[model samples]
Target: MQRAISIDQKKIDRYGKINGDNDIIHYDDAYAKERGFRGTLLHGPHMSGFAAEMGARKYGAEWLYRGRLHTKWVGPVCPGDVFDVRIDEDGVLTASVDEQVVLVGSATLR
Candidate 1:
């Protein structure tokens, strides 16, 4: 399966609030730019959630009850970026933007 995941400032801020990731780099543009990022970045775990979603879509409750996910973040996701989220038939999950791979991993169920 394949889908596009769009991230925005509102979602980023909300995730930060819920997950207690109050890092200024994820919320403040100037702070992030000072750190050499294009804009306020997204929480890594929040981006990883797209993989969990793919697992759930494929494995149903088993994905939740007995799923294992391992990810490597190769790029950053910022507001207004659109990610290509997909689960290959091999069960590998990947998230990409503009030909740049942001995440790569696999979701498995027991």
Candidate 2:
């Protein structure tokens, strides 16, 4: 039931590097193109954070205590790609980017 969250480049870079992902495809446009990507891609965890952020905003900070999340990055999440985060009554959360379902999972709110 939460609105979508749009992550910026700085967040992706900082978080991606923190997670030990130094793939140029994630932070270097030229290198990413060499690897066939239009630009740096968003790390998978970034999407996770986006999902969590949406959950907190919609259901409050207490909603994630006993929650669960499951998602698959079907494709690389490029910079500037805004995603929509949705939560259903059953506790399922879905993150969609450009019509593609990037993150899908469930969590329990304590």
Candidate 3:
């Protein structure tokens, strides 16, 4: 199954505040552009959380308590990007933006 997630500055700011991740790359467009990104980049963990949510939806409460998600951030995700989260029958999870694989991993529900 697949799900799409939208990332925006407001969501990024709120996640930053809750997680104490005040990195300029997550909110400072100028700073991020200076660092070679399109704009302020989405936090890796934030994307990972989205992947986890996909697992939860697929596996129900079992995933909530026993889900294991291992992910690698392969590309950058900017605000306003709508990315796809896909889970195959084998339980592999992948996230992509603009047809580029941004995050890849697997979700296991124990």
TM-score of 1: 0.94
| Candidate 3 lDDT score at position 74 | 96
Per residue, candidate 1 scores C-alpha lDDT tens digits across 1-110 of 98897889999999988999898899899989888888999899987888889988988888868988888888988999997889987789999988999999998876
Q: What does candidate 3's lDDT look like per residue over 19-76, in tens digits?
A: 9987778989999999899889888998899888888888988987898899999999
Tens digits of per-residue lDDT for model 2 on 1-110?
A: 76756666787788976899887777777888888876778888777777776566656767557555665566666777777778777767787778887777765465
In the predicted model 3, the residue pairs found to clash are none
Model 1 ranges off by over 4 Å? none
Per TM-score, what order, best first?
3, 1, 2
- Where does candidate 2 have its weakest 10-residue lDDT segment? 63-72
Worst 10-residue lDDT window, candidate 1 = 56-65
Estimate the Cα RMSD of every predicted model relative to the unseen true structure.
1.1, 2.4, 1.0
Q: Give the poorly placed runs of model 2, Cα more than 4 Å off.
A: 58-64
Query: Local distance difference test, per candidate?
Result: 0.88, 0.73, 0.89
Error of 2 at 10 (Å): 1.8
